[model samples]
Target: MWNVPSLEEKEPELVREVEWFRLYTWTHFSPSDTCRTYGSGVVQPFNGSAFYVRSNCAFILTHFTHNRVEYDITIRRGDNGLLSEVEIIINKVRTVLQNGSILVEKKSVSLPYDHTYQHVFRYGIYTRFKSSLLPLTVTWHDVPGGIDTLWVELEKEQNSDITGLCGKFNAEAEPKCPGDLVYQDKGPAYVPSCSNPNPRFIDQENTSSCVCPDGKVLNDRADGFHCVTVSSCSCVFNGRTYLTGETRSTRCQSCLCKDGRWHCSENSCPPRCLIEGEFVTTFDGKQFAVPENVLVFWQSSMYVQVQTSFGMKIQVQVFPEIQLYITPPRNHSGVISGLCGNNNDDTTDDFTTSSGIIESSAKLFALSWSLGACSENIPNPCINTDNALKCPKNQEFSYNLLACNHTCRSLSGPDPRCNLQDAPVEGCGCPEGTHLNQENNCTPRSECECHHHGGATPPGPVVIDGQQW
Candidate 1:
């Protein structure tokens, strides 16, 4: 007889673990073309918001009219970035074709990298590998007018180190000094030159040296005499106090307060430097409000982060992948030097998959607004069994009564031993076809057959109903 479990007795668990050998998972450690099941292609944990993907360590910095690039890459297997005998598959999405291996010099093979945070490898991408060296050493080109598509994949010399990352000439890159580094000689921490897009400020004193209090490039005001401030306007000089005023600009722009405490031009709510709601007050006591638009995401982790935009910004991250049977993607195709994983404001591929599963790219963006946004409670799933037509069907219940006087278990929560068991109604015995047996079960049996005495007589099934008789 089959080993049938009795409903009244303990029922065995119905779920079984499944084998998922074919699913894929992405991580900080990139994967090989052939899926050898280890480390990201990157050697270190990158800092910027973007990087370039390439097949080799070389970067193409010059002009290229050609549409594609070809490189020979050899994969190195092992912690030391050594070459291995195994080969990997490279899937091409442009033409939907599988291409040949990226050879190292002239040979074809796979390489192994620890892909640890400290050893990430990256470079500028080349559709075709025949481009000349960069016009200027260390420069980026594939970037959109504003897009930062630098998350690239490339190979580097054996045992490469990322602590000493090199940056190329971003001709468009904001001149470091003319912008954020502009230390003002006035009470205001003026918006970066990148914001107001102002010209450089050089002091008119000391023979073509030092910056003028105002935002103007000045030549020699050279003399043995000391440079004097208007003595009414205030500006921060060398982290010290100084007064600035229009003494230079008809005192329109002068150092009214010389001790870096006040600005004479426009005093409409100064911008104070703040750290996490903490105010950094100077000894002289000038009040300023910290702009609330600033935000830091993924700070001091893979990359220290900062926001350079205005208006509303949001920061969110999706983790703990929910899909039980599928793996998320990590083989980022586009990377550039000094940038990785979607930091720029323009077009980016920051994880947009159809599956409900979550991945690293599942980040909550930073939305900046003058007035902060508020949060509300999330609604719970409806469980009104008495309401909808299908609600009763959705209501599922099953229980097991173990032997002995032990109570029955409930499925609701961690608390077990529910007491909802009610015995069958009194005198509502077993149905017609079944009868109580030695095992306390309602056992079913075959009907008794009758044969005629004569050998020629026919046998028939006994029936209690009039129609069957």
Candidate 2:
């Protein structure tokens, strides 16, 4: 008895797997003739010199010629109806017949978002078979787990290999048009008839072979190589039309494309608390980018730090409940924004500044404060001297500025409240002949009865020194 290997035991010298997906097609120049198909479709098998193979289950709607193809994939979110980043995979194959045997090689490429990819057989050696009839197969893989759609016939050019082959084989009286020559004895299996009621059955040739680098459609157009984006109409991107709230991004912000417009919001990242130039001699030997006149306080027990510029009048306190409290200036109208809380997971809060820098007060802080913070009045034990209580940024903290019967600094003279040395003496006072009122602005002083001995004085200029006016 003669021993023979089973069909399953001997693998074919050339084998290819092309995953089929739903595809849409069109037959006419108008948009009304659009057609669609969903499920596996087969391409006609090519009977070459030594081997014959058919692309099974994969949709073969058009002839794929050796040319650059372009298409776009539309990706959408599954949970919500929003568009998402798309990923595409292309499987490339190379086949050659040498030494009376067929050899096969495979490779792949991955792409993100909507992009066009080319499928050209210009491997120099492969071009040598310009006039010879050979068999080749191309496959593409779609990224899984996303809303994937392939828009075919958007802006594309479709060519048939018979036209190229005729030009090569018939060197004299070369065919100028596909109708000039005739081909026969082809199966309907490879004929793409989704859009056409009757398609001409011919040997499998390249027609519209290039699907979206990420989608599942093959189409041909006469208006040059173009593709319809999956998420766009006239406002299309890549190839598809996008609905409202489809998001795209740049370095600083995320932009949502909607109804022919783009709405963008800031995409902020946490700022690094770096102290440049000098390694921190204190606080874990870290580096920081400290601005001039800025003070940084690190509390070891609380494991928190505060960085404020000198004279800012802002106070930052961290309590046991992992809360950060920021007190802005007395007349605050500025914006204060920075990172806070633990290093691993810091929190952020923003407040309108009194000055252009950073500004607010305790009760007023509740007006527009963010980050879900509360107050516990935790005083800093490290600050013992009065100098540390000086105002921050653009503010003044007069100890008794609102107290009655206190000596007030005259507006006519330079403001002494700004001087940290005079903080102890700073008090609220009105100009001469005025008294402190509910409003901080000075008001006219009330007349009072005088009990001095009766004496009438007239307005006159008198000088005891010899120079009298």
Candidate 3:
């Protein structure tokens, strides 16, 4: 019976004693050919993602392709550390011809098992244009079931490792029969018709049986009838026991022991500089409301991270010394490098301004903005404030300085135009036709005309007489 576990069941925790194996595939094809495996390790028999599998190591020189490729490989074990049998199933969307020949299918041939019960099979595809030479390197491992965690890899095969392993058996053997015929009184041979894919003796011969070669023994457990040598099966690292596919976690990295080597990856660590809440005090001792999603973190050695809502982020790293390194947000792809400096009107000792501008020493360029500023007040460049606007009496214009989409510096002073030099220039504007272009300059009721020949231009005073327009 074919044994497959139910998918609804929760996977059990992996033990430390069971051995595991890793199976990786490499493929390459394109203007630049490369080899990469679709998945890794001996667990998880299904791969929903599509990827190519190369024959031999020549990635760029192949023309075959397979679709809907999936693998179902299982290894069964018996008593006394013996591998009872190995079963493999590779089902994919394949095309067949009218003559009834399989094309674009995985062709595999099983081989003898070693002392550790490791079975190696050479597998590839059969297509109309080409049939891959027998013996593609596919390994089947014996591991405890119900544990799932795997990673894929990209690699290339060099030095013809695939062809080098062709025709090699798991154990060495020799024929026990001598060259000379021992008995010649044999019955007459008869031909037999064959119609099934089954093994049969070519001709009956009276001869001695074969035995294990030198320095080898007939391993009774391995397939019950195979020759193999002995080797160590235990592996230990850092005072902890590790099996073939089991993984371990350190402070900054995670590692998995495969075969005998360890593969590790760095973990994502926390940042050095951190800011929380919706309000941040600037270097000038001003408190302003920021967005809720603004987060700043330290990245790499010299760079700081400013991540905003959505997928937007600004990387801030120090320049050689005097300036800052601020890469444009990835979400806003076309934005160019910007300035980072203090607000000229801000009298803060720290170079970082209230508006998130980092003033440079030479005032040549602004490097980066703060996370708070990037989210709430980017492009506007000025710190937003809440203040009541006071126009002269008789002017009687209802205006709130805070409603101007910008900022107001001082609430108790005239010309409170929010003139932070490094910030974007923004000021108060009066109602239509009543000019309030400058601070405290609210002019009204003015008309001018200009004319060169037959046409008169309104809104200014310019004429063929060449007066100021």
Candidate 4:
């Protein structure tokens, strides 16, 4: 049978095995049993003897050096005035534990490296690892009680090479509490963070508090608190978080969140205009109806002119009334201007004059854009009070005279003149039984005007040069 090691024989080995040790326990008690509190403590071997120190405040729990490797451990309190976070730094790498989560450099990561050994216990996880520069095995147990237990087991040759809260290994000294207790009924300590970098503290109290490593900031996230450089932090917008290099777009602009701010650029949106019936919507989005009876008169001496350009025809009339009609092409949009208004879809500045001032009065605005001098006094032709010049007794007043008074004089088959219809003007026209003749009089269809070679003649016998024909 194999012989097992006896309890007495293993006692001395177990006592000398661990160079330093610490165990944090929950000390806060609640009478109502409605709130939870956390606590902290430390235990280490000093001069071949073990001692313990306990506290409920946040402070630098321990800072020691062993075999040229530095280890720093700190306890931090939360907003609830209870110990909540634990920070550990070995060499330059930092790790934090808060709210049952582990964070390394502001990001959650799996515990127990490839070289580290891990074990799961009934209460928590236990991890152990030994770095090349450190001549001791470092072990820590994550407990459910909001505190952790740490142990440093040294090699036999490195027994007297340790210093700090564990005590100077070469001297026999009594364990003492750290003088730097922090957050004893005090306000919070504001440090640099992703959301609030370069924080300015007011009424700073003389106390020790845990901070992120050099050149890093605290990133308080939904999961837990993290320590990271400013450049690696995500941006928060509209109550949502966006990673670096993410982008968003709107109707007029495109934006990206970078370096904790929004960078935006205007979008290139072409404008459009709408002119429907009496209502005109400009390129700048101003909407209004054209005023009634405000007529713009071109000089009567100017002959009729037709110009074809931009896939559309422009017809200028200067006979009974000065009128202009432009039939724009399907693709002709956003580039036209003048009396019709800029077709750029924005109506706010449609009445801009040649002098660059936007005029408010439509009549004055139209006058400002006229190329030639207009008659100072112009009469409204539609307001004819003379009953003799009005429609015949049998006729009725029609708003759309083009359809109601179409006669042989007005019908020129397949001609451009037939397509050039006038705008609807208030006028008198013949009723169903009669049509307007070339003599400017209403008559029955049997005595209507006659058309020969697109020329119109009155229905009665005509006398030309005093000869009856």
Candidate 5:
């Protein structure tokens, strides 16, 4: 038979079992906190049973285990008598945080080690248990004076089972210092960071400076400052950080940010004009309100005839269907502008108004060139409604074969009345290179009958101007 311990007797045992390890020599929450003098020595341990010191050299700082996971912390002192590096080993994995900068080595792989238990934070790393058990946090302050300090916090159930430089867990044991006291001013004021890597130091100053490890610079974001490599740096535009190789498009240019700079292309969008039924888009890309009496620029009655100053004639026909024929001159390649656009081969500025200003609205631009006010809105004639004009059954629909159709009548020579520049038109006439002969049939110019005074005459020649054959 065994005697059961009462709650009163077991309380101390349970309290001793749940031990908290807050490891740090300096108790200040921040490096900039007020300074105070304590027992002399390069290294110090708080709430620990014993403290030890060694000459400028590397040595194991502490060794502990929690939940079967082993943690080893080591420190190296430089020849200048300051902490040079602090290495932490969790089980088989190792990470070295060097002094002067907060640079940590790539973590080593360790099998059978549950990586989810560890978490990396801005200032340090922490490990958590699956249950609501307290976490073990290790913080490394990389400042000049604080670099020598290693911070660790853990909760244990068995305090008596622990032993190391951290000291015995029982409160009765006094902390013993093994080295002679040497109270000195905190080391240099600051550490180097990416933004200000080479910080200027003041002699005998107690201020702390921020720093980052080698090959890294400080990157500012909305949240806070982060250290990043040079190649990984991002570009900031309009207060926004843009990753490298990102692109942005504007109205006239396409820009990409590369190497912390913006590379842009020349004007990419050409001016355009659109004049649809109820919508009009100007050359400047602005849409204008449409009027009820929107004039039809491309279509006209077949009876309408146009005579251009540049020796071009456009004749329309209403028979089989509304058709307009164009007869262009061999000369005059450019120097023309209107609804047909400037024939200069460039279509960019086709909407130049009469005032010489390129207009963005087709309605306004066309109004500038209008000879008179447009008539009342007319119903579309093409819409097949009752009372609409119908084509004769015997007559076939006529389509404009070419803008410049050569007829047999023109075979004799150019018509003086139609000696106009080239323009598109449509009319009821024979196909190109054919003439209306005596039989009223379309015949090739080579097989066409002769004409006398605008009258079709048979191949048998007739007298003309006192010349007979």
Candidate 6:
């Protein structure tokens, strides 16, 4: 009997585990970047993370939505490799910034975790938000025994990736086209009745051993799939296997074959993009290419679904009118849209699909706005600051000039929606008799002068010094 050494008797050698650790998440697109159009959305629905894996550096981005505003977080790996920052500016006035402690590799901590937006009934979360892309930078201890610190200056977007703003991620794709691709087969699979798996497939090889064997054939059980037409009208299949019953339908039965178009059958063919114009919307700023059969709806604001080759429905809306301010204000929450798109074929609504650039290096932009909100208080038209009853300026309508007295500079801005800034126009000057007080506009003296108006006295030429004497 051959004696085999027991498992424990084997030479003891230590195997090292591959170096792996976790890093804290960092969140903030850039320190500071200018933005025009203002729009905001929740970054994370639940708890999850995104990582930027570089040569020797890896950082994790964690996010969660509270109330409606989103909170961002960052984490890095290595000894004392942890760095985190989150900043928020509301109404361009009150600001809140939080920084975390320096951490080591494989270390973790859940801070008193509260930007503390009063998400309660008395102080519910603010529904409005804004964001813009700015240059980004990161610092870490990736030096000696550490990794190389990484700094990235995100390129300014010539045109932001607006497509992602309008795009819905394609989680997975499913079947969308006909399964049976028109593939011609040979041998028994091609034979008329014999259903031969292998035969005299070559057209003129008159060999008796290969011809479609008459009577019982060794090819009776031929297997495979194919598409064939006899008399171009009645079609049949002996080896084709479908989840449902066999198909003998004519070529014209599926979809209209207008203008000699071929009948393509693949269950998962993707549709093309329908973006034709410089279509910009509140959605992502990524560029999108127009595709065939894709209906880009300028008339309607809705999602233009991209049926991928895997049957996964990825939605890319077309809002050619986003800049036009037709429906809900650009910064407001609203749906912008595009029509269905098909391939390059002349077919319009045939509903067939073609492949698209599902992945690309496209830039993304976020629109934003700032301050200036107006008060809704309508001042009494009849009363003056002196508590005196004043005669209406526009008598026919009893309209008070003071009622329209709006100060443009008084508008709280830097954020458009804040105090609701004054409208884009020059304001009114002094009233008639008052002739502009110290402010140089209108100031009512003892008797209100109607000079500017018809009743007001006109200014007579005055003698300078003693010239009149």
Clash counts per candidate, in order, are 109, 46, 12, 12, 30, 86
Candidate 5: C-alpha lDDT: 0.45
Q: Give the Å error, residue 157, model 3.
A: 35
Candidates ranked by lDDT, best first? 4, 5, 3, 2, 6, 1
Where is model 4 more than 4 Å wrong at Cα?
1-42, 46-52, 56-69, 75-83, 115-125, 156-161, 169-469
Candidates in order, TM-scores: namely 0.15, 0.16, 0.15, 0.24, 0.25, 0.13
Q: Residue 376 in candidate 2 has what lDDT?
A: 48
Write model 1 residue lDDT over 305-420, tens digit each, in one string. 23322422222221111111111123434432111224334444433233322244322221111135634333353534352221111121112212111101111122111221
Most accurate candidate by lDDT: 4
Candidate 6 has a TM-score of: 0.13
| Model 4 lDDT per residue over 254-352, tens place | 778776667779555455343322234566446555543221211112222232334454546433455676767658745666767776678987987
**For residues 1-469, what per-residue lDDT tens digits would candidate 2 score against the true structure?**
1121222332343122222211122332223211111122211212111111122211222233444432212122332221122222222333322222223332332221121323323332221111112232222222233212222221222344421100112212311212111222221223231123235555534332223323211122212222333233123344555455677664446777743445668546333332111113223223333554553432222223333343443322333234445544345455334332122222332333332232335344333344566564535546433334433232344434422232122222332223322112232234445532222334443322111123111224434335463
The segments of candidate 3 whose C-alpha lies over 4 angstroms from its true place after superposition are: 1-126, 129-232, 236-303, 306-469
Task: Kindly state the number of residue pairs that clash in model 6.
Answer: 86
lDDT: the better of candidates 2 and 5: 5
lDDT of 3 by residue, 1-469 (tens): 2322221221332111221211222122221122112212212211211121111111111112123333332333333233333233334322221122222233332332221212333223211111122212232222343111112111332222211111111222321211111111221111110111122467644222233344333332222223343221123565556655788774446787654346778555432222212234443224454665664432222334455655454655342232243433445534233233222334442455445454554221222333333333225434344444443432333322221211111111232122211212122334444432212233453432222234335454444455564
Q: Cα deviation in Å at residue 231, candidate 6?
A: 11
Off by over 4 Å in 2: 1-207, 211-298, 301-303, 306-469
lDDT per residue (tens digit) for residues 184-247 in model 5: 2232233333334456855535321233345555453323335566556566666677787898
